[model samples]
Target chain A: MTAQIIPSRTAAEAALAEIFASAKAGLPGSGAVEKLREESFAAFARGGLPHRRIESWHYTDLRALMREALPIAPAPTRERRAALRKAAAALPANSLVLVDGVFAAELSGKLPEGVKVTSLSAALAEDRPGILESLAAAWAEADDAIVSLNAALMRDGVVIDVAPGASLAAPLHIVYASVAEKPAARFSRSLVKVGAGACLRLNEMSLGAGGRAGQTNNALIVDVGEGAEVGHTLSLTDTRPGSLRLETFLVRVAARAKFDSFALVTGGGLMRRQIFKLFAGPDAKGTLRGVSLLRGREHADTTLFVRHAATGCEGRQAFRYILDEESTGVFQGKVVVEPGAQKTDGKMLAKAIMLSDAATMNSRPELEIFADDVICGHGATCGGLNADQLFYLETRGLPPPEAEALLLEAFANELIDDIGHADLVAAYRAEVAAWLAARARSETRSVA
Target chain B: MLEIKNLNVAIGGRRILNDLDLKVAAGEVAAIMGPNGSGKSTLAYVIAGKEDYEVLSGEVLLDGENVLELSPDERAAKGLFLAFQYPVEIPGVATMTFLKAALNAQRKQRGEEELSIPEFMKRVKKAGDMLDIKPEMLRRALNVGFSGGEKKRMDIMQMALLEPRFAILDETDSGLDIDAVRIVADGVNALRSRQRGFLVITHYPRLLEHIVPDTVHVMAGGRIVRSGGKELASELERTGYREYAEEAA
Candidate 1:
């Protein structure tokens, strides 16, 4: 299969091959990583593309979308630049911007003390300890054409790790910004490690004012350590129709460690966010929550897989989506309790509120348990506002339109309040209200 | 100031209120005493212009304006308020915010300017104090995690804030203790005036004790079967709705 592929004449793929040659020059990582890359490239050559039949990529069929290879476009010139910097202003970091899978060092900011913000190429060139092998082995799937393309073509993706027990106040931010020109595909990854009792706040802003057709972005990793606390917040809003496919990998919560992630998807052409959090240590816990607001033909998919490998671990996942117009929403969540994971408690709630007949929501919640002593539950609700509830509000003198707003606000408000950050909650409420207003206005216009 | 002529209402094709007739003039506090399933709530809701009641036939005239054609918000603009028996809570929306929105909505409909934030706050603060409601409760989400008594208090507070020309109290005393009932009663009484009318719906006469009414109507079989003065409520309290239920059957 490997020999059957790898020889294709396309402008982008040929350029990717050249970039691969440059990335291989003076690579710093050991022969172990070189062999992994060789195997991954070979697998990618053979597999060619992943189809919808692939169970893991059922919701996101990357094979059909990647029919033509889209290589990393070069960085912006001084006079003509995209809004990458403006979109990433919220994340405080030794910030790095990857445009079309290639890094722009000039666009990145300075790193803080004891923090090294450099490209994967630089890390490999320097043979950085604990940087290359773990992620390459764990996250790099040889068959994923996109991840493989990222590995084969990505010149710079920020890699930061905290030495054992070393704490830093500022986080290392990885910003993914897109601009509309041809088919844009970018593969990016971030490997973060925290020390015992250390804390970090990673903020990712997936933003763009507008884009043309054929736009794709894929991101793969983030880690929180034992006794460490990490808070991750992402606000993703795209202009026009584009696709955002991201896989978040989380491991390492020693006893008493904590991880909290709050993801907000304002609107995208199509967004599928997968978060796989593995709680392997006793009392190692985490909370994951997301809100995806969609309108137009935009679609948002949030898939979560949380595994409780140790006893006395607590995990929670709650996500709310408001789909209007002809938009589609999908949520698939699973909480698995392995054997001997006694006292493992988990809860997940996925809710989708549709405002129009064309709006559709698909939700599935699964639980697998081997432990006799555990409490795990998952529930999903898909519907319009309640008739009794709407009548109740209308009876209070709210118009039918305002009544819908009140109900949706009431629904999303449930999760918004649980967001620990007050400022973030306030901002998110405004986002929800704005989306509702826009949806209401557009819907009214169409009705009229 | 309010009149319902030949009112008929149905829920999912089942008639709940059939050809109901009632009237409430200015300065009237009319008590509607009814047994279970007597469509007391249906009457309150239909008159308040709630959706799904399916008013099959009727003319609801509020101060000579045909209200059956108007939205509930429009009725509210015309000075009609329905104190929900079980008020629907709206989380993330503060009580003060709702009050402000409602107040401004009514004012705008009346061609009046919106109250400044400070002015609105002062007005709410007055009602909060008059109703003995904690100021903190106003800051919280509307009735979220509120006690039964507090929810009713919130309803009264909103009623006081809107200051409608007519109001419907739908079993507002169902879940209140004596003290909370007194507070709600006092709040309702404070809004009472010679030009404002109120229709108080209750199954228990306990509420009438706190807020005395001018007249009491016994609703049986979805219609008002008997009419009398305040003494009628006391009579029903002495004798349960069994007599009305027997007659209804």
Candidate 2:
């Protein structure tokens, strides 16, 4: 008999095994859903965690970054709920609040007319019509290990459905607040559907309390109906140093539909936000824009994949990163035009500004076109601030730090000003200013 | 008052300015006319505290204060300004905002309160009108996509807003037409006061017709080879720098 060799399991794998062994019996769903959970976990087990060997995850090796998985978060208590409500109160009115990955109906304000919102767990328990179908649609196209793990362990989220031809009078806000007393993890998934000819504005924010280390895995799936208009924005900030966050967004745009997405990441120790957008019908338009401000030892990665599947579709992706101290930022964007997708127009750009010698940025922008008549291009640049520009601002009477902050703000304002909403632009600007202030304070302290 | 005594500057290990000596008293305007490679722009940049040039010897004094140890912004706070020959185009930063920030920063360094938004608007509007700068131009990015005349007008507007005690105009008339040059010269003439001084560096003496200088110096081989009164500008305009160039050689 030939000798057999076995590879040792990593810490993440060992933690996954333990979680699966203890939580399998109590997990939700049956039949197809149960089978899906089992199959997804099995797939994750077979592959372990993504490392440098995976081309898509070359810059962010999760297996090495995430040493061990924290235990699943416990149910939210009265005190935690109170704290969450306080935090939610500071956000815009008519917002949905999720505490510890569970939807809090009491905390959520009144909903708009012609809109329906329900808890994902309650829908799963009642076997709600179209719930399984909607979840299965995204599952069919997902091939990522982190997304697979989220599918296997998702506990609860919110389900939103907008009536056909209806236009929302006000924007909808979703606040995800993590209030864990100990080191823990929470997984949540949401589904949103905008009806044909309808208009919807959705905003999301993720906040974590300070202190202990915590992990959050959240996923969102959006379906834009024919001729529908959807505007979505996400803000992830105020994350603690020990926090680990992974957020994934999957969007499908139909014929003549328009979808715009903007995400701002300013905090978090380790984070990876991915967006997969599919242009399913002709004449569709989609845009993805983001800004990341990282300092300290924080590591943030944004990966985007936009596929043009129909003729005459257009897509654009732009992202900027400002890294300081020992932080690292990564941007990987790919635009693919399938065969027969004639007249497809796509462009992608990634730019980074490194403020310190120890700061690092990895940018990869790729374009793959299988069609002859398509126009697709991508470009990436990473460098420090321009010396001439800096000197110009300095001669205008600005100190070094102030000049740098102004340049950084101008760099990011290119995208923020394009948001077209006054309140949203103001909010984003305030966040950028706060980040710059903190950076200046830290620099002063170090110098002292 | 601004003074450069026995100044020697080297850039990239190559001597650019050799034993240059000049002085401009308060309320006086000095013109430096020279050929293409005479380092007129180098003198302007070195005075503004640009980092590229190395001062081998001598000192640059502003009101008896050695400015070599200060940064560019510090020099600005000490009332020194340079109107770039080719004004930089900074996208996404509105001209009005840049003006406000610059004004406030200078005020802050001098231990003064920041200007209110309305006050700032009033000041900019007054200066903008004098320089024929439209409101739309102020709303757009600073010098981005601006015409050559418009950029020089914007520079004059900045000079008016800051009201620096000492200003250096480096090739300020390089790209402007006759009408644009008149408007720019008028703007500069409006800001000229007994407490302020100016160093007007130009390739041609045509601009001197509007903002005539009190003294004219011919620069060649990196030094001021000849010094004369305002009549020298007209003389140099007609005769060129051939005589001074040969004398320096």
Candidate 3:
């Protein structure tokens, strides 16, 4: 028999292994949760970092891009905490703040009636009902190594609960902030549970302190109860170079429930946002929209998977990307209609605009319909801005730059309007405007 | 106000305008009547500084400045306008937004302050009313889902708002009903002034009946083959362009 051979581990894998070994005891969990973490870590170890060989990760080679995993970030200093608190105070009422993946109770604001918020660590220690099961549910999928890793290294986050029949007056804001002065990493997980007949609006915003090139892996789980209406928005803006982030959203829509999620990503070294949604009960409706604006050498990937396990469900996914300079964008969406899920209507579309020759966009939309009476379709289109549209605007006295900006803004803002919250829509538009403004400045400087 | 001297333009090495020379002086409304493939639209586009065609050798002067070197927007600021035969449908951009942007951009390029909301609204309301445009239509995306008549009326409204020193209406009457043609013509007549010149490019003499031209030119194979008084338009409508097409060949 020949001698056994073992390939050497990648730098990131080795660093992750070391970090897990040293920090295992300090991780927030009890016996059952600890076992679940061990099992997840074991699964991750068996698979290693996702690579092009993995069908879902065809466009992103995380093992190669994540060269070395940085150490975990430490607790914030008093000054930094105070600064973050002041910043959080200025956000909308009923806000929750997290610093370096850990919940900052002092930074958060008061919650409204019929709503409760608790730190994920406390929930895990107290063995909250269904919390452990929720964390492990996603592991059943074969290509969930990233989610498994997040589970193993998860530190702290928040668990929000909305009471039954309660209608929230204001949206709940969750701000994920990183104030690390040096390269580090953070793993956080949050859950939102909307009870039956309740209505809730949630906003997730991630802010990275300037000059900090850190890595973040956060998971958000949303469970929409029967007849619940939930609107969720995630806006991620981090311009720091060398920063890498991976955010996973797991959403479940129950009977007659309506779930809408919008994600906006701009500026960051390397980013991957993957959403997994399931129609768990009949007559549930789900809508997912994502917009990514990338420039410079930034790279952003948005992947979506929707599983229709219940009959008479409707699902729609629309994504848009605007790439400039040498930036790259990728969109991968897959919709699966289970064998018994008849009368299911699902559609997925991804459209991208490449501004420069050096820029690149990859889109893949797939539909797997096992039911005979279901209507399911997928489409993807990638191209540069329309020449005729640009010329039309220019002929109306708008310069080339101004014309381009207007078209680009319109392209991105069209989806922002679908968020349904007037204030949030305005905020998202301002963010898009700011990104365009920055791009204009860079273009002018290059021309000069 | 606008002069084209020996303007030879080609697209992809195929000549569209062959040594074409035409001039429109201030206070003059010149009409160009031609058959299909006569390059009437090409002449209008070239004057508007569209980049699709290659100018082999020519000079397009607006107010004594060679507009060939200026961009399309710059040409617009220099008081040049072209109402396209087919107005582009731009989704996601409201008609009012496009109008406001165009008006402010032109003003800024001319080093003039932008109009306030009330003033801008007043101008839009006045021009839109003349074209029979509904306020709801202005709230929709520019030219998107608009009928042919509505599109033509929108272009005429834009012309009224811009008040260009010289305007070229390229086949503006095509695809329009008789009622639309009359409405569009009336809108153009309201903008007519001694200081502003107009070039009405069309095949039929129906539009000229409303906005009578001072000079009428017949074009064939890119160049103007005949020029005469307003009666020239009526003559072409009766005699047809078969002779001019053969003459150019």
Top-scoring candidate (lDDT)? 3
Q: Record all residue pairs in model 3 with backbone atoms less than 3 Å apart, i.e. clashing.
A: none
Residue by residue across A42-128, what tens digits does model 3's lDDT show?
888887899898989889999889999999998877777767766676778888888899998887888899899999999998999
> Which tens-of-lDDT digit does each residue in A1-448 have in candidate 2?
9976655789778988899768766766777777878888888887788888888889999988998898888877678767666777777776887777888888889998878999888787788888888877787666788888988888889999998898996789888877878888888898899999999989898655432568888999999999999999899876778788899899999999999999889876899998889999999999999999999899999998888999999898999999988999999998889997899999899999998899999998888899999878889989999888888888889888888888888888878888877888898888888988888888899999
Which ten contiguous residues of candidate 2 chain A have the minimum total lDDT? A205-214
lDDT (tens digit, per residue) of candidate 1 on A1-448: 3555443434444444555565555333557667656665555555544556765456666554434545444444433354655555554556666655445676677766655556766776576787666566445322355556545444556676666565556555566655536555555665666667777767665445343444454554666667888777776654355554444444456677888887777665666676777786898878998888888877777877787888899999999888887888888887888998999989999988787899888888989999999988889998877776676556556667886787788777767777666766776678778878877787788899
TM-score value, chain A, candidate 3: 0.97
Q: Give the Cα error of residue A303 in candidate 2, in Å.
A: 1.0
Candidate 3 C-alpha error for residue A147, in Å: 0.2
Give one digit per residue, the lDDT tens place, for model 2 in B1-249. Answer: 999999999999999899999999999999999998888899999999889999999889999998988999999999999999988888878888789989999999989999999989999999999999999999999899999999999998999999999999999999999999999999999988999999999999999999999999889989999899999999987898898778767
Candidate lDDT values, in order: 0.74, 0.88, 0.90
By summed lDDT, which 10 consecutive residues of candidate 3 chain A come out lowest? Answer: A134-143
Order of quality (DockQ): 2, 3, 1
Question: Candidate 1, DockQ to 2 decimals?
Answer: 0.56
